[model samples]
Target: MEPKHKRRVRYKGTHPKKYNEKYKELNPELYPETIEKVIKKGSTPVGMHLSIMVDEILEFLNIQEGQIGLDCTLGYGGHTLKMLECLNHTGHMYALDIDPIESVKTKERLLNKGYGEDILTIKNCNFKDIDLVSNEAGLFDFVLADLGVSSMQIDNPERGFSYKKEGPLDLRLNPQKGIPAFIKLQELNKNQLEQLFIENSDEPYAKEIAKNIDSYLKSGQLISTTTQLYKIIEKSLSFIPIKERKES
Candidate 1:
């Protein structure tokens, strides 16, 4: 049998210039393309305010270039914009929200900020569907799940998330996706209400709150506004602590 020729081992010096050039081709944003344009032109939505803990969030995540991230709850895109500043042009940021309205707002903001090219992908979907979205986009380097309603949604009276406002009791972040808060209250029994309060708010007076809800339902006193609910909750519980009272 003829002896097999030795396979040539490729060393850094032995490699062709094309082989070294491939690295630059793979990461043009880092090597050749200017990332300053992307960072310098970063924009925030009108009236956008970041959370107090944004710096802490960034520190914990330790965002780096060429890293993909997901803002699971793209409230006003404050965190999203910050992450965009940290990411390379090659890095992708996926901002997901169930509300079509917010999605539209975010899209407009991103377009104005010059992220319309491909750095960001906005999806109108729930957090549960993020895995599917990420799977399609490959895994993310960082994933931010800012659960619950955003300050903007809560501050906006039309959304009906604030007890201070007397808007329609429509607390479904995405009004088209789930039943409104009023409808949900109408459907829920006392036990269900208690369970929801306990699970979500961790209120100790959940049972009492549920009893009050039952009483209101039985008396035909349909409470269809956040203000009405707030009054009911306030009246039901008297000695709640400040922290607990705020939640109530």
Candidate 2:
């Protein structure tokens, strides 16, 4: 055997375990379980109520570090935050929403978390006109356009997206942008009503619905609320059972 190796000494630094023990000893009020959870969780995570097929989105986009991502409908910033997590420090997110109130809330929350110019760009504008928005941030490597409404609009009673909710007849994604639902109802002609039924609700008796709506307006009982419109539809087609009617 070669010369016997001399015994080597290993030195260990003062460990986190020792520091934690000392900290607990000094602060008896601290709950160990809570502290452990905090250490594990790091910071509070943001929540979202979108039907974003995240897996599909990522698969199509092929997100990578330092890539730029645009969330056309950044409802509550769910996709934005998720993309940020995957992006490198140099990467950025441009989140857009038509709703001013919702946009403001999302901006404040993102800014509060130390995400500044390097991390995020929030815009309160419609996604349909992509040129106006893209001019600010230029072309993005990944663009996520989640078409249609979000759960928050439906859940929030004030937004009036839900028929069950007793609120104003305002179904606009951006209250300031589009005609209010009630006002839109007033503007619909028989042909327009028939078209709306076919496109949006896919009503089986689209022609019948349009005729009934015209008749109801003629009676001076124009629908102004979801409840009112629902009642009109029910009464107009009372001859048919609701269950047997074609689904939208």
Candidate 3:
């Protein structure tokens, strides 16, 4: 009997790089659908924002035709688009976002889909400034504010929100405004850091972590990236046994 030879199997066609602008531009029609698929599979596309619990949100809002609405965190216009559909050309939707890049793109996308200023208006501002925009645009019958950071923001490494990705330590919702989280960490004293972790995160090891972080900052070992900070956190928790770590 002849010895069987190992055969190498290769897949054809180049796989598109995740979040590649060229891929999105080349496959304009397929891009949005691809984003939906990714979201359904429990993962988010790098630059695409998925609206969560859309049906629930719409049902809860009890949107009616000709009723004005406001979408405070218009991440990628997913919610805004649905609201506009419900409005059915009779009402206007004012969408606000702090992300200049995504906001402009979403506005253009919505406009391309035939939603004009008569029915849709996009504003480049934080929801915290909603009072100003609302006053200018007039009152709204329904308002939606997605308070948490969108998946798009967290997935984009350049925005620096994920510890898994290697990026700057920035955690600001608006990169153009305010100092990044790394700088903020440096500015905070041990007490402030401890208090932040305790109040904001309810971390059990807040005091220990804050002390370590303060020492590192004072010693010029700057935690400038998410990975660096993540490492510090891992190291801080290393003393705990693996079995007990979960409860901690």
Across 155-227, the per-residue lDDT of candidate 1 in tens digits comes to 5566788876577788887877877888889889999999999999898899988999889988988889889
Ranking by lDDT: 3, 1, 2
Write the residue-wise lDDT of candidate 2 on 1-248 in tens digits. Answer: 79988752333655322322343322322455644554468632211254357777777788898877888887777677777777855688888888886777667666766677668888787888778877877888988888767655665556777667466778888887868887787788899999998998887788887888888887877566777777777776887876765652
| Better candidate by lDDT, 1 or 2 | 1
Give the residue spans of candidate 3 off by over 4 A: 1-29, 36-40, 244-248
Residue pair clashes in candidate 3: none
Instruction: Kindly list the per-residue Cα lDDT of model 3 for residues 186-213, writing each as its tens digit.
Output: 8899999999999999999998889888
**TM-score ranking, high to low:** 3, 1, 2
Off by over 4 Å in 2: 1-51, 246-248
What is the TM-score of candidate 2? 0.72
Better of 2 and 3 by TM-score: 3
**Which consecutive 10 residues in model 3 have the weakest lDDT in total?**
18-27
Give the lDDT of residue 8 in candidate 1.
Answer: 39
Per-model lDDT: 0.75, 0.71, 0.82
